[model samples]
Target chain A: MHFEYQVDGGNFSNAGVASSQFKKILKQLNVDPGLIKRIVVALYEAEVNIVAHAYRGIIKIDVNIDKVRIALIDEGPGIPDISKAMEAGFSTASPKVREMGFGAGMGLQNIRNNVDQLDIESVVGKGTKVEFEVNLG
Target chain B: MLVSELKEKLNLKVFGGNSGLNREITGGYTSDLLSDVMGFADQGKLWITLQTHRNVMAIASLKDLSAILLVKGQQPDADMLELAEEEGIAVLGSDENSFEVSGKVFNSLMQKS
Candidate 1:
């Protein structure tokens, strides 16, 4: 099955809606409980990243019989340094965003820690594409 | 111990998730950082925080938390309560701050266990 969700930047209130919905779908599919938790955590962090930084983004999920693939593509000020961004304590979030207990620079790392494979690509001023996959078998 | 028993012992106020009063309580996690709680909190813990936004409920639900306990008399936003009610994870409160509530909850759980 395939699913796509749209995310609007700065929409804090609706940030986790997509992740929650996808979690329901995973439950219906009877995905292993532990695997479901990890996947949802990665999906939610990625989803919040789009809302926190990008102007907007699209999340595409391709669920196969044995694995799940996810990609989040967004339009915004692209990452100038992927390596630096992956650092656990590095973040460019404004004071306002930090007040909400996010933007601590742990997002990408969290996504990486929970997923089987993580790949991120970006341009200086255009946008970014994040992709990853997890095995279900 | 069940969430309802904790509420009674601690004198917590239940503002929503009335149906989850019987949910099991595995432990307690106190933090204001969403990512920290998401990363470290285990299933069925009661989250103690001052954040009153809807995202708190989102994290609590995603983590399979038993309940959210608002500290320092923090009142949850309307949208936060709405989601808590829908998710059926108890959203309780106390007038004490994080430090005090954490102590009381810790002591209570220790006595029971």
Candidate 2:
């Protein structure tokens, strides 16, 4: 099964809707419980990143018998330093974003922590695409 | 502590998913940030926080949490309540802040176990 969701930027309240829906799909497919948890966490962290940093984006999920894959593509100024961005305590969120109990710089790290494989591609001024994968077997 | 007893101790108003709640109370973690809560909270503990967003349900679902308490009398939005209902997560509302609620829950859990 495949799913796509448009993530509205800077909207803390509506964030994670995509991940939540994706989780349901995974459960219905009878995916492994541990894999489902990892997929949900990775998807959610990426969704929060799109909401926090990008102007707008799309979160996509592709599921099959063997693995579940997630892609977050955002049309925002790309990450200048992928290393810093992946750091657990590194965050560039504005004060407004922080007030909502997010923007603690854990999004990328959280995604990396939960997923089996993670890949990030970015251009300085063009955009960023984050891909995370979970092996179902 | 039974989920029913924690409800009374914190004077919580069961706002959603009353029937789906687990009777077990393994422990609790209090955090307003959904990210921290998602990373740290165990599968059976009551999650105490003032954050009443859909992501709260998302995290609770991911963690397999027993229930959620919205502290400081904060009420979840209509959409959040509906989502909680669908997800089978008990959403509780309380007049206390996260710290006080955590303290009370910690003491209760210690006493029970």
Candidate 3:
């Protein structure tokens, strides 16, 4: 199965809609509880990243018999250094975003920890694309 | 322990999601950083934080958390309360800080076990 969602940048109010919906789908499909938790965490972090930093984004999910893949593509000021962005405490979020209890720089790291595979591609002044997959088997 | 039990035991104020007060609580996590809780907090945990934004309800619901306990007498944003009601994840309030609230919750849950 495949699903796509549009993420509105700077909209904290609707940040986790995709993750929540995807979680329900996973539950209905009877995915393992542990795997579902990991996928939901990764998806939620990715969703928050777009709302906190990007201008706008798209989230695409592809679920197969053995694995699930998530792609988040955003049009915004891309990361200048992927390595730095992946660090635990590095963030470019504005003070307003931080005041909402996010932008602590743990977003990507959390994605990495929860997903089996992670690929991040970015171009300065353009946009970014993050892809991750978790095995359901 | 159930959320209603915790609220009664800790004397927490219910801010929203009264429908979910019967949800079960397996554990508790206290963190102000949304990502920290999203990354490390487990399912069925009650999140204790000072954040009172709508995103907190999103996180709580997405994480399948038992409830959210706002510390230091913090109150939820109007939108946060609305989302909590919609999502059915209890939003609670307390006059204590994270340290005190977490400690008390831990002790109470431990006693239950």
Q: Name the weakest run of 10 consecutive residues (lDDT summed) in model 3 chain A.
A: A96-105
Model 3, range A45-77, lDDT digits (tens) per residue? 999899888999999999999899999999999
Candidate 3: where are CA atoms >4 Å away? none
Would you list the clashing residue pairs of candidate 3? none
lDDT of each: 0.92, 0.82, 0.93
Q: Please, what are the lDDT tens digits per residue for candidate 2 over residues A1-137?
A: 78899998878777877877777777788888877777777788888888888889998888877788888999888999999888887888888777777888887877888888999999977789999888888
Q: Where is model 2 more than 4 Å wrong at Cα? A: B15-17, B20-23, B75-79
Model number with the top lDDT: 3
Report candidate 2's fraction of native contacts. Answer: 0.64
User: How large is the interface RMSD of candidate 1?
Assistant: 0.8
Model 3 chain B worst lDDT window (10 residues): B54-63
For residues B28-99, write the lDDT of model 2, one tens digit per residue.
888887788766677887888887777777678767888888889898978778778877878988787788
Name the better of 2 and 3 by DockQ: 3
**Candidate 2 chain B, which ten residues in sequence have the lowest lDDT sum?**
B16-25
Candidate 3: residue B70 lDDT (0-100) = 92
> DockQ (C-alpha) of model 3?
0.91
Per-candidate interface DockQ score:
0.78, 0.61, 0.91
